[model samples]
Target: MSLAVALEVTPLPLRHPLPTPPPHHVGQPPTAFHNPWPSFHQHSWLDALLTSRRNRDFKPVPPRDQLVKIVRPEWGNGQDGLKATWIGHASFLIETPKQNNNEGGGRGVRILFDPVFSDRTSPVSWAGPKRYTPTPCTLAEVPEVDVVVISHDHYDHMDAETLQPLYERRKGKINFLVPLGNAVRLHGMGIAMEDVTQLDWWEGVQVTVPTAGSVKLTCTPSQHFSGRALWDRMSTLWSSWVLECVNTSTTATAPGPASPLRLFFSGDTGYRYVPSEATEDTVPVCPAFGEIGEEYRPFDLSLLPIGLYSPRHFMSPVHCTPEDAVCLHRDLRSKRSIGMHYGTVRGGISQYFEDVTEPPRRFREACETAGMVWGKELALLNVAETVVVRLDLPRLADLDLEHVRSSKHTKYFGIILDLFDASLKKTLERLRLNTNSFSATLCPSLSLLAQMRKSSAK
Candidate 1:
C-alpha cells in the first residue's frame, strides 16, 4: 500500500492508555505523563549511599568465559530471521526480520540498544559502578549497526566513548535515536544533529528500507528518572521503545508472508508507582502495562528489565523486581520474554534480598507463579548468548481481519472515554466520537493489509 492510502486508513492520533506529557514544558520540567509519581525523591541519596556502604559481601563476578564470547557469523544472518545478543549491562544487538531472496535479497535491520562498552558507568572512568562482566563483543566486532537507541542520559545507557568509535567505524551512516533533551549531549560528543532523532513519550517515526520494509520506532513511556549530573534531574525524557517491522514483500520465494512483527524494549525502568499516604508501607503498582498491552500486546518478543530492584524501600518506585518484570511481560502480552538489566553491574541504593546473580532465579520463581514455563515462554539469557525467534506469519493472515480492525477501533473509543474519566458517551450520544466516524476510511486500508496477511498465512 502506498503511504497516502495508509495515512488515510491509519487511525488518527494513536490512542494511549497512559497520559502523555508534552515534549517540552515551557518554564519548568515536564511531569510524568499519567501517574503523579515523582521521578526521584530528593532525600534518597543519603539512604542509597549508606545502603551501598553496608553491602560488604559483594558477589564474585561470573567467570570471563561465561560472561563474554567471540561473535559468530550466524548472529548476523538476518534474512527472515530474528536474533538478539546481550552484550552486557543493558546493551543488546537486535537483528530484525528481513525479506527473503525473492524480495531482492533483502537484509534485516540491525538495532543496537543502550550500548555501553566502557569499563565504568560513570561520568569519569576512575569512579562509579564498573562492569563486573566483560562485554560480549567489542565495537569493532559488532555487525554494522543500522540504528542505535539510547533509553536515557544515564552513563550506562548512553556512553560517549562507545559512540565515538562506533561513529568512526560506521562513517556517519549510523542513526542515533535518543530521548528528548539529549541532543545537546550527543552533539557535544561530535555526532551530527541530522543523524540523531530525539523523541518524547508516544512520539514515533518510520524508516523505510528499499529491499526490506519499514520499521516504526515509537518512544513509549517508562517510569525512570534521568540525569548524568546532580542538577539536571528529569530535564530529559526517558523511555521504553516499541519497534514494529512491517514486511512489504510478496512472492513465492520470500521467507514468509508480509506480516508485521512487533518488539518491545524496556529500557531502564521501574514498576508503576501509585500515589498513597507516606505512612503506607508499600507503594501501589499502576496499570501502565495493561494500557501498553491494550495497544501493542501479543508482541513477537520483548526485552524486560529484571534486576536492580533490591532493598525494596528505595528501588521499588524506580526499578522492577523479577516479579514485576514477569508482570510486565504479561502486560505487554509478549509471546517470548528474556530478562535483562542484571548480572552486569549493580544498580540503585539498597542491597537486594537476593544476591546479584539471583535475578534469573527470582525470574524463574515469578514465571512459575504466573503459570509460564521458564525456557518455553520466558527466558533469562546468559551474557553473549543468542536467542532466535522464528515467526509464523502465514498463521496471522488467517485471522479475522475486520474483527481485528473493529477491536482496535473499539479500543480507541474506550481510551477516549477513559481519558475524560466521565460518562461522556451517554451525554454526547449523537457525537461522532466513536468508531462509527472512521469506518469508511479504515475499511479500505484493510484490503492492502489482507494481501500481506494472506502471504504470511501461506
Candidate 2:
C-alpha cells in the first residue's frame, strides 16, 4: 500500500483502557489545556525572581569539553537496532528499527523530537535564555529526518529558526506531529496544513514509512502549562508522547523477534508539586504518569527531562528535578531511560538556582537509590552522543529452554546465552546442552556474557 493510504487505514489497536481527559478552562478555546490535577502551589513568579540572585557555588555552564562530547551520529541503515542521538536539551533524533524493503538495504524511519538548534531559545533573538552549550553537530550535519514530533509550543522546545530551515532543507517531505492549537505555528512557517498532524491528549495516529513499516504516535498527558509570551498563557496545549513501532511487514526480514519497539518522550512534565519547606512525600502528585505506566508498561526506551528544576515549590510544578525524574522513570516502567533538558541553555530567573551539572549527579544518585543501575536501567548521555539498544533480544525469561534444546533456532539461544552469566551457563550444563551442537559462528563472544553478568551483579 502507498504510505499515505496505509496511514489512513491503519489505526493502532487500543492496547489499554483510555486515560481520562485533561482539565480545560471553560469558555476558553477547546485547546486551552491544563494538567490533570492541580499542579502549582502558592509560590509566584515574583518570589522566584526575588530569590534567583542567591549565590550558587557550582557553575551553571560547565566547560564545553566536559559538558558536551561531540561525535558524528552513526545512524546505520536502521535494519537492526533502535538508535537515539541526543541533540541537546529536549531534542533527540530517534530511528526505529527498519524491516527489509524491496531494495536489498534500507534505512529506518528517522523521527526528530523538539529540535531546537538555535543559539538562543527565545521568541526574539536578542534576549531570553541563551544556549551555553553548543549543538553537538550543526543542523546541516543531521541526517535525513522522516518525521518531526513536537511536544509543545515553548520557545525552548519549539524554535522557528530551526523548523523553517528544516522544512526548506527537507523540501516539505517531513511529517509533523504536534499538540492541539500548535499547527497554526507550523502553518505560519509555510508548511502545508496537510503535512501537519495535530493531536489532543489520548489521541494517536499511525504513520507508515516505506522502509520502517508502521509506527504509532500517541499524544499523552503531561502536567505542564504552555505559552510563548505573557498574555498567551494556557492558550495552547502541552503534551508528552509515545512512539511504538508496529510490525506490519508480512516478511520477517528483521533480525529481532517480532515484538514491537516502544518509546516514550516526556516532552516537559512535572511529577508533583512541592511547597516550600514541605516534603514531596505527602503532596498530591500528578497521577498521569502512573496511568501512563499502566497503559504502556515496559517502554523499551524513554526520554525524560531531568533539569531546570529548582526552588522545588515553583519549578516542581512544571520541571523535573533529578529525584523527581527517578520517580518518573519508575512510574513509567521504562526499561531504559535517558535524561535530557539540562546542560544546554540556562533559563531565566527560575533556572538560576540549580547548578547545570547538578542534574546528572542527582539523577545518578537517585537511580542508585532506586536500585536502578546507571547506564543500564537509566542514563545521562553527552550531547551529540548516540546510544543504541538491541531491540531484537527477548527477555531471558521469555526463552523456553526446551525449545532451545530441540529447535533449529539455536542461533537465538546462542545470543541469549551471551547476555547472561555463569548461572545461565550452569543451567545449560544442567540440561546437558552441548556447545558443539550450536553453530559457532552464530554464538556471541563469552566476554559479552561476562560483562553483562558483572554489570547485573552491581
Best by lDDT: 2
Off by over 4 Å in 1: 1-35, 38-43, 53-79, 100-106, 251-257, 272-283, 347-354, 397-458
Worst 10 residues of 2 by lDDT: 409-418
lDDT for model 1, please.
Answer: 0.62
TM-score of each: 0.74, 0.80
Q: How close is candidate 1 to the true structure, as a TM-score?
A: 0.74
Candidate 2 is scored at a TM of 0.80
Put down candidate 2 lDDT per residue, 1-458, tens digits, no spaces. Answer: 11322123244555544434435432334746666476544345677656675654335566776665555555433225566778899999987766554232355667899999999988888988888888877788888777899999998988999988887766546788998889998998787788888877777888776545557888888888788887887777889999887654443454443667678999998877777544565566677776776677657778999988876666788888877776676566566688999888888555557777778888888777654556666787666766665543334232211111114321111111133445533533322232222211112123332343445444
**Which pairs of residues collide in candidate 1?**
257-455, 257-456, 310-352, 393-456, 394-456, 394-457
- Write model 1 residue lDDT over 344-431, tens digit each, in one string: 8764453334367677788888777654556655776566656655555544431111101124222110000022313322322221
Q: List the residue pairs that clash in candidate 2.
A: none
| RMSD for each of the candidates | 12.5, 10.1
Can you tell me which runs of candidate 2 are displaced by over 4 Å?
1-22, 25-31, 39-60, 76-79, 101-104, 249-257, 393-458
